[model samples]
Target: MKRLRLYFALFFILLAVPIVILLSHTYSNLEQESFFLYRRTAESLMATVYQRLQENLLVEEQRPYTHYRYIHVADRAVPQQEGLNLSPLADFPVQSKIPGILGYFQIDPDGSFHSPLLPDKDPAIAVPQREERQEMKDKLATLLEGLFSLTPGLQAQLDELKLEESPPTAKKNSSNFRDNLESRVDITLEQRYEREASESTYRLGSKEDPKTDSLQRRVQKSSLRQAEIFDSQLKDAYSQDLEKAKESAAPQRADDAPDSRVVAGQTNRAFQMGDELRSQDKDVLSEPEAEPEVVAEVDPFQSEVIDNRWLVFYRKVWPQQRRYIQGFAASLPEFLESHLDAAFLNSALPETASYLVFHQGELLEPTPAGQNNPRPLLLHSAALPYPLNDFDLAITVAQLPQSPAHQLVTFLALFLSVLFLGGFLGVYRLTVKQMELAQKKSDFVSAVSHELKTPLTAIRMYGEVLMEGWVEEEKKEGYYQQIHDESVRLSRLIQNVLTLAELERSEWQINLTTVQPVEFVAQITERLSNQVKRAGFEFETVSEGEVKPIQVDTDALTQILINLIDNAIKFSKDAETKKIVLTASQLGNDCYIRVRDFGPGIPSRKLKSIFEKFYRIDNEMTRTTRGTGIGLSLVKMLADAMGAHVDVANRQPGTEFSLRF
Candidate 1:
């Protein structure tokens, strides 16, 4: 049994380790999946905002340079000199389309400031001069001043710009532009145009965020987001015609300076600028005029945050060999409310999640929701794509949402664990019981062999001595008597063994008959008195009250009484008062027969187990009692077979075995 228990413990430990690991691994996967799903949703929403900004920027990049000034046509004919010279600063539709646009400004390389709200430069044009335009300019100046006051670093940069002959980024941007133009010189006009258009579109370069990269890879593999596919095949004929057109139509530049008249003529052909400004301005040049040669190139917009509270986006356009900075500034609060807040509100992210905006590494305000929480859990962080590369975005959640299968997996793990533990416990207990029963059977066999050998040896020796005629007449009678007693004892032992075997095989049947208590007691005493006397135990039978009749099998009940009396005689033989009492009593509709011995009583805890087959309180090899351990077990089985119940109890000086019906 001990060895079996050790094996069960080892097995349980080995199995439990993997079970625990499996459950833990499952839980970890569920947690990771939940976080991954949340982060993907947040990133998708951010990408939507990015795409919107990119589209807007693309539109701004495509703005015609001539749109900044007004032109006049004379006599409904083309003449470069007939156009009006208006201020390049004029209100445009881009101000209304973009959110939180304070105003647009163009800064000359010579440090001259110009606003779109400024009136026409040429006074010959009869256009109304509104006071609000001046107010708008003043407002823009105040906005810049307030923003510069808060941002010392940007203010210093602006002061440096005033001292420098050219902006710090001009050389690199100019070199890139020149390289692009030179590379396209050999291409066909149509092919060059197509390639230029493609190059003008910004690439959202890969950002270094381990989590986002991992999630993006997973998202792509899952095909959760579909990507656009474009055709790569080109027309060879179109390319040949475009190449001829580029060489024939291309004009030469004079003195390394571009003529705005020629550029405007080229631009007007596409945009119809002369028609737009003809009715508004009348001071137009009558003929072509000579102006100093100039070169021009425009760079993409760049964005920055000032004092974590303002966003400024600007672009550099070079014309006439001089750089011009054109851009707008807006307050961060309005920007967030217009772009970030709107996107967040429309996003599918959970309510517990928060979107945080950061300038450089510093956090920006209008504080995001849940930012002030005691411990905000961060889910994903990523840098915005250019022109907003200076900013970063972080998503946090007060509490992450659980995975859809979390509950199911948890319950399944728990149920499996419980089932496994229960099975192990049940099997272990059953194994213990079986092992104990095997040991008991072994002891029973050894005890039975000893018991049979003792009596059989005595009977055989006595018969052999008598048949040899070696004893005198009187002594021979004594020897013969010994043989008779030993034979009877051996016969009774054999009968009990056979009865137990029959009961074990479930082949025993009972014939229950109604019998009076007095008659039953008389029958029991007559059958068991001689056996008890022979064993030197005084036997007595008593009836109490008006003992009621009981429904019992008479032969079975007699056998039960004989086993009990025999047990009492064997157990009480060593007592000072060796007495066995058979008592019959009536209580309401029940009749009880109790056989009690005045000897050492059974221990309270062991009393119930005394009826178990082959169970002995004393060690089998060390016991002095002359009886098998199955007597009480047989008694209980007979009682139960007869529709009666049997139990044992400790008496004042001994133990009582009760049979109730």
Candidate 2:
């Protein structure tokens, strides 16, 4: 049974150690997995956000310029003459007879390009001089009258051509009567012709007052054909100038310098001057002038060259603009609303969902507009870089539900494994101790049986011999004595075995008697004295402290003392001075009896187990000693039954066994 228990304990211990080690490793892996998942989710979310931003920017870039029709231009317009200051232009009516012309112009002539005109504001108006205004009014009336006088068929043709052609009737009404008097109706035709010739010469750059000459020639021209041709050319030139102005008002190229051009609806004064210069070659010049007229290049398209305005909306803006952009971005929330859940889904681990956006390197911190008027988070299929030029952004979203419980389970598993291992080890150590004790008991039992059988066999043999009359009468007496001693030893062994068995079964009861300590010691000494003397040992007894009687079983007390004395005597057989001493003393309410032997003492290693069942000091002296080994074990049990303690200690010369009752 002891061997089976030892094997069972060893098997359990072997299993428990590995289980504890495995549990610890599993717990560590769980923690690492949690962290890895979090990092991966964060990175994925960042990529999604960056892609959305990039897509939005691309869409805005693809939008056409015609959709945003309002032109942004400079605020000031320069005049034709160097010192001539001009007021800002009036707001022109956007509704025009022409279907596509939305009449508005930005005129910044001085080229101070700071302020931009918003599309919402009216076109600037310039204050004109009264004389210039009257002149403009007369010219406009003449042009309107001519337009109205055209025949319906001609007007249809003109409309088809989309040409602003002046009618002949209006020109004929403005002609002079000098050419009509040619049919023998002119008495001073020569004088009139010479005056007309002189005025033409003056008009043709003869250095004689060109303004007066031009006015005279206009009054002198009586032919309706000449007047019609001049009016038609002037109107064509004026219309062409307007078209050029409109073209110039559009956005310019990147490298163009700002220069003045004829304002829309303004008279082409430069064209008029050039026309008068050209007339000098038509029999109108009397002499060539030393200097030629300086004709400026009149590109009406130059003023229309508009530069594009690049507005970058950063985090901060004017309150109005800030409010506008915020509202604009806010309006997109519904478009992006469905993507929030998708972001969570994309996270590989639940706890990682919270850190998802942070891992996306392209995601940026929320701008003021984004914060104040947030848009729903949107996910995109591709990744792009965030436009955070200065600082990095780290954002945390909702908490993730990682399986902490699972991790906890791992920890608990490890803890349980360790506990199981410890339990197994404890059971194994206890089993080993129990098995050792059992083996000793078995050996003791076998030895005791052999020892008992030897004495009993001797007694039986002697009886048988006596029955056979195999010895002399004197020899028979000696044989009977030997038989008597053997019988006593056999009886003692049987009594020890019975007492031990009772103690094991928890049935041993102490029958108390008030026995004097000194008497008890002396009686045990006298009983063991014959054996001690035969073994060449001296026996002595000492009593101290007015030795009082102790309450104990007389037989049990005597047995305990006798066993200790016998053991001492046996072990002291080869000692130089073989002496056994029995002593008793009164200590408070207890009595102590000590048996001392001047013999080889018990070994130090065997001292602790000396009182255990069948435990013997493993030495040559003890091996040779005739003992069942259960004697001291029985002594301990009997002492315990009497409420006494049995202890042994090595003296300087030998060993001492003491019992306190």
Candidate 3:
């Protein structure tokens, strides 16, 4: 038994080890797979956010410079003036697609401050005409001042503009507005007209601003290098595009025309017709031709983050010899929230992770998750594009979510573990039951052999003594009685064994007959009365309450009664009050026959399993009783075959076996 148990334990361990290892391996793989899937999603979301920012920035970059100022028939100072003019930008709310814009401003090469909100001052214009404009200009300047005061970089830039606008000496007023305006008019109307009429190109920046120290301070070494590289590339691409556009727009050459003479003839005819009309109408006058506009050289825009909360976008413009800085200012937090946060929430990224923006190692405000303690499971970082250069974007996930495949694997593992353990447990229980049954059967064989041998040996000894004439005359009758009782007991034992075999093999046929319950009881008791008396026990019978007739097989019922009586006599033969009660009664719809013995009652906990085949209350090794265990088993089987039920219960002083029909 110990060896068998050891083998079972080893087998269980072998089976469980592989299953546990397999589950562990599967879990590890699933974890890695989930992380990989989340990482890819984070990467995709970051790329999408960057692309959206670039698209919006492209829109801001393409805005024309003319949008910053107001257009007028002439300058705002001379409303009645016949010439066209440009005025300062109005102080009304700025209309822009970008969010959080404060205002727009410009800085001249000499650091003079100029805003689209503030118009150029003129001594000729009346105060009434410029009153409303001056009010808006003052409000805009005050707003700018308040914003700049909070930002160090903005404050410095504003101070530089103020320094540039101030003259070095008192005599410099002669070279101020009036002379500057005249010089601009001479360059545009006189010198430019002459250069154009002479068919000669006037190069931009032919006159350089004498002040170089201030410009150097304003532009950093790295920023200048970047600007030069970017501007050069931009110009080359622009030139290629322009050449392609011009070639597409240029008129076809006469040599290339399919019918050059036809085209020439049509042109001549139109000219002749125009001349005739002009001759007929003497009052007609020719309109003056418009002059070709000269394009200025504008540098790419550059961005500066001020105090980590403000953003300044500025670009340098070189028109002739004078340099101007044109740009706008905005709240950095509002810009990122309006642009990046919305894009992130709308993307697939937020489903599994969050993001943070950092500029020069400083974290930007309005973080997605709004928490900073949790460690990120997956992190992806990328630098922003130009203008927002040096800014870093990080996508983080506090805990990576389980993927569908991982969830599926987990469910399957649980199911498999349950199934495997359940099967193993079932096999273990079945094997234990089989081993127990085998042990019981072995004990039954030894018991039956001893029972048969004792009876046969007694009968043989008495018969041998009578044949040898060795018995005294007075004891001869006692010897005969002894031999007859032993023969009856031996015959009964063989009959019980044979009946049990027939019942197990399904060869035991039951013939049913109707018999009165009282008569049935009387006949069963009469048949077993001698056997009980021989065992030296007093037996009694009782009938009650108009017992009904029962449908049963008399032979099978008789065998059932004999087994019960024999069991009672065997177990209680040594009791202090050796008595048995055979009862017949009608209780409700059923008729019952009971055989009760005055012996130690069966234990309560073992009551239910006592009727099982080969089950005995006493262990075979220490048993003092003299019967095989098959007596009660045979009684239960015979009763069941007759369509009756058997029940066992403990009486006050003994055990009762009932057969209900």
Candidate 3 per-residue lDDT, tens place, 1-661, comes to 6777888889989989998898888876676555445545655665565566667666655554443433222212232322223332333465555678766776544444556553332122112224544555554455445433322235345434442442112111112333322321222322323433234321111223232112322212222222322232222333433333333333554334333223323322332343354458565568744433333455556677777767877766543323456777777888777766676677665454666666654556636553533445434445565556556665666565677877888888889878878887888778877887787787788788989999899999999999999999999998998998889888888998899899999998888899997887887778777877877898899997989888998888887888888888878877777999999999999999999999888899998877777777888898888887888888888988988999999988888999999
**Residue 437 lDDT, candidate 2, scale 0-100:** 74
lDDT of 3 at 248: 37
- Put down candidate 2 lDDT per residue, 1-661, tens digits, no spaces: 6676767767776876677577656754553354334434544565564445445443432221111212211122234432111112222222222122222221111111111112212122112232343343343233323222322234234334321322111011112222321221222322433443344321111132221222210111112222222223223444443344334454433234122232322223323343455567787468865432211111101011011111121110111111000000111122222233444455553432221121122332332222321222111111113221111222232332346766677668868767876887787778777877777877776687679789989999999999999998889988987898888888888888888888899988778988777776777777777777766888888888887777988888877877887788778888898888888888787777888988878788888888877776763234766777788888888888888898999998899998887
TM-score of each: 0.62, 0.48, 0.65
Residue-level lDDT of model 1, residues 1-661, one tens digit each, is 6677788899999999998998888886776667666656776777777777666666655553333333322213345533322323353322445677676755544444556554223222123243555566666666566433322224334545442343323111122322332232222322423443244322232343332222110000101000000000011222332333334334443333244354334333422332333336655579845433223455666666666666777766544333456677777677665766777788888887676665554555635563544445555555565666656666667676777699999888889888998999899888887877888888889878888999999988988888898888889877877887788778878988999999999988787788998887887788767667777878888888998777888877877887888788778888889898889998888888999999998778888788888888888879888777888888888887987899888888998888889
Model 3 alpha-carbon drift over 4 Å, by segment = 61-93, 99-334, 337-415, 469-474
lDDT of 3 at 432: 79
Candidate 1 vs candidate 3: the TM-score winner is 3
Runs with alpha carbons beyond 4 Å of true place in candidate 1? 1-43, 56-143, 149-356, 363-379, 396-428, 458-489, 517-519, 533-548, 572-591, 603-608, 651-653
